[model samples]
Target: MTITTTRPEPASADLGTDPQEPAGRRVLTGDRPTGPLHLGHYFGTLRNRVRLQRQGAELFVVVADYQVITDRDIADRLAEHSENLVIDYLATGLDPESATIFAHSAVPALNQLLLPFLSLVSVAELGRNPTVKDEIAHSRQSSVSGLMFTYPVHQAADILFCKADLVPVGQDQLPHLEVARTVARRFNERYGAGIFPRPRALLSEAPLLPGTDGGKMSKSRGNAIALAADEDETARLVRGARTDAERRISYDPAGRPGVAGLLQLAALCQDRTPGQLAEEIGNGGAAALKRTVTEAVNEHLRPIRARRAELAADRAHIRQVLRTGAERANAVADATLAEVRAAMGAVGSA
Candidate 1:
């Protein structure tokens, strides 16, 4: 009903340089359109992306709208959700002008690109992909759809079409990243060389930042702290975070996940380490620790949330950004598509 065609390719940020890293490298990275970004994204990659942009690197922040269909449960908020994500991104330091910001649903050509790309990859390779295995296991969907099963292909198409050289990914996502690299290599091997640049993975500074509940901070698990959440919401969520019965404050993630989770949040917010904060706490009680961490998180996210609200007001502006981004993204993708077709002999040959 919502024009469920193949998702458009996402926008990427990276310099248009040769694979030899001439000048600088181009980057393609983004979050799923399933929900708003969270602290995990912020500290894990968003912060790094902002730093890269400032350093005169070309970058693309894809909204990954096509990924939403792999788990198309959020039918009501498909378009609206993607638009909100754009707003959150703008409020953060992801300047649209500096980077292309396209959604999956908007660029149908990327999906068309997937046909040939998927052929280059083998079924065994897809089966061996750890991320796909994890998603299947986590979703518990006995009969997985082809879309869910072949997500790596979509990822390959996403990065390949954009010719992204750098894709910052978490360690857990290495398997998928590997798939993308493998596909890039395979394409070059099948056709001539230089079909697409093999994207490098930028592993997170602190991979898998634990949620307030001491579990992987994910939306499905209800443990994530949304980036656009207000000060009151952030405080309430922090207050509800899991902690240990021991009153004394100490930072031991393995031994005391709940309490350590608080410390991690505090440290990340204050730009300190959990152990350092633990030493500073000396012999503070758990209540004091939670209160302190909550306050710190509140302080850190207050400005971000406020800025998000201001940006959310003009949804039209966000749409314009995405629209403008698609034009720029397609300009690059179309040329690449033509090259790919010519290389594969698909252009003039019926």
Candidate 2:
């Protein structure tokens, strides 16, 4: 039951800027409405969004409804899912007043940027993009859609449409963000107008939280405990979480990912290091570890779940939030599109 003190450095080493420095920076980041957000979404990006909003960053949190159809043939309950995501954002402390939480489909001008941006990137480049490849493979489709093929370009449109200066991303998303950077550079060079900012990645410092089953947290796989899960549901999920047969608990990820993931989960909630927590729980066995994790997770998420219930009870308020955000997003996107048209000499009128 020994605890190891070693851990990998945070991903923020990619960019030296402090995440707390908000001044005049515009950030654009979001999630597709394909599934309910879980602990992974919280630690990965949602938490950052809230911090940025409070820090005074001009934030745009998109409910990427359009992207959901890239893999699924039919976006079942698309509207419901989108609203639910907005609720999660609200529950997690993102102010709709400070942050624009709009649906991607609602912003036509943003989607229009896709066509002009497509011209800037080569088909070969899209073919070689590892992120797109991984998404397509996981899509489990017999044939890929034309839209899915140009996924990165569409993302470029999303970023540049609002002239975002910063985009928070993980290592896996760096490739997608690179496409946006490339498009910005090429657009400015070809059109001779620096209309777009090369959005830089505000790489996350948080470790990737694994699912209860020790796999990637995925709502489809039922491994994730959604932000909306009640206290009983949270405890039940944690109790069923995978763990090794060792009688003692230790923070050895390589040797035992499941046990390590559980420890990490508890640590994130308790604001203590995994190694320290592991040492405290020395010789406590897997059941003791699971009990600790369940208490920590449920306690941490208690307020968020309560807020989600309050928000979900008011559907009208949720729709109004989306409407207002869409209005603001449309204005910004329209201005950007107009400038892009004027630069390209396509300036007659729609």
Candidate 3:
């Protein structure tokens, strides 16, 4: 597969939560902003978040800027990149009113809880985290910064600070969620209190969206289909995707990752199963299959692009949304941190 892509203008229309009553469980989730969000983001968790919003669940989306800097000694573009990430998010339909959105840097209270929570968790356990190992290897930085090593601790702070009852994450992150639960459990066990409810993983239903090169669809791989990518760019990436030499189409991820990725993307956008899509491919070769999937993706993302541009135009409005979200998030987080302090006997006693 070979793809030719165009740079797309950011969109701003609200495909986000509309006027609806709240639903069953409260959910919390967010992304790190090393770059703009891609299709993997959409198919992975954003889709689930939007659906939950319509169902009337109180959802919190964190920008997670602080987490991104864990490996870097210092960053020159942190502020700029963080703003762009927020723009991509709002452009993609994160309504400030419906879902709370805040950056990790803006909330000092949440970070305060980390010291105490870390005390409750054993270092031996943190060392065993697979994510830590994977991330360190990816960074290829001789050794990880303390911040990087305990990135999961900050994650716990993010969740526990909000008193999150439910956290939506991918399967790869169950361990971090487990860590958050452990911190909550140990604190409650030792403090004679249950200040933080153990949050459960909501989990993603969509299959992991693959990158253009047939690897994991991450920004670092350059294999992603960025949500902000223009139609031509979308088409191009679809074209360049690695497919099987078989010349005919089949939906076997193990056998044809490139073809299977296209199928997966199409299946997600079309709301059909990969098997359902495979039957439609008929005798078409990989090129034909890629075209069909490309069209489906381009059509689906058109509106999101338009909306992202509209949102991008009003940078101030986007900032205001984060400000409001921070204020709202801080209100809850401050209260939680206070309780956490009291639990650790940091607060006044008789």
Candidate 4:
């Protein structure tokens, strides 16, 4: 049997002030604390999260520790990785006072919300999720974990537990958010109560920078420039980045993905377009282009790296920030879970 899937409409137009949500909107966005964040993350969603927080939106940035174990065999590194993730969030200008940041595993209520949400979605439907399919393919594993297979259901609980009206995600992730919307709709329909909001995807305006190999920027790919990378390491990575044999510096992504990748990185750093930079560099050659891109990246990252170093030294303060964040998050999540249980007529819902 053929199972067809329809993609959600890109919510680009809905980003500007939603008249429906006059009291402002609550937003939920997160990163799996599998590794240190990189420039790809900064441009992809981190910057947008900060902007939304400053605009008075109730923002929740979850350090998704539970999601990290989907593929990782070494669970011991989660502690260090989770800490580093929060440090990167702070260093990247995410104000703890403005945004509620917490680890996913810290919220037991969120996990409890998962069972009902899972019942709302079918196994065949879950198998059809584009994001899950892509992730499984990317994992290069022969067998899939049950936790990984049901990730979209868990993600639904994550958003609904906060009653998030907005979910900041890339275009590629819109389908996953759509699954959450479907689950929310199904639950409300079955329970005859509007407890969960259908979270809309807030499409990011930032340009996605490709990896050094011109593929998706990923930590496993080893092409990403970590936000915690020191100046020397950053410089070394950029200098050793792959580029075409063609000496002329032009922005033809299809023909020269390697050079185009560098140009895209430079464009993002300088807040300019790749074509504009390519034209300006006109025949400056690949060597000159690499040098310019490398400097721009290092200069941009210098302050963030310094801040991360300082935060790393004061582990006590980092722990405090996370501890307080967890408390704040639990307060909200617990209340939501209570309402969900009451709606479903679960025992001890009172």
Candidate 4 lDDT over 189-246, as tens digits, reads: 8899998878877778776689877888988889999888887887788888888777
The positional error of residue 89 in candidate 4, measured at the CA in angstroms, is 0.6
Please state every model's RMSD to the true fold in angstroms: 6.3, 6.3, 8.6, 2.6
Badly placed stretches (over 4 Å) of model 1 are 1-23, 72-74, 140-142, 348-350
- Give lDDT tens digits, candidate 1, residues 107-213: 77777788887887777768767788888786634577788889988988888788887777766776777777777777787788687877777655665688888
Model 3, stretches more than 4 Å misplaced? Answer: 1-24, 347-350
Total backbone clashes of model 2? 0
Please give each candidate's TM-score: 0.89, 0.94, 0.89, 0.93
Q: Which candidate is the best by TM-score?
A: 2
Q: Sorted on lDDT, highest at the top, how do the candidates line up?
A: 2, 4, 3, 1
The local lDDT score (0 to 100) that residue 312 gets in candidate 2 is 98
lDDT tens per residue, model 3, 144-191: 788888888889888888887778776677778878878777889889
Of the two candidates 2 and 3, the one with more favorable lDDT, higher being better, is: 2
Question: Which residue pairs clash within candidate 2?
Answer: none
Best by lDDT: 2
Each model's lDDT: 0.76, 0.86, 0.78, 0.82
Q: Whole-model lDDT for model 1 versus the true structure?
A: 0.76
Backbone clash numbers for all candidates listed: 12, 0, 25, 0
Candidate 2 vs. true structure, TM-score: 0.94
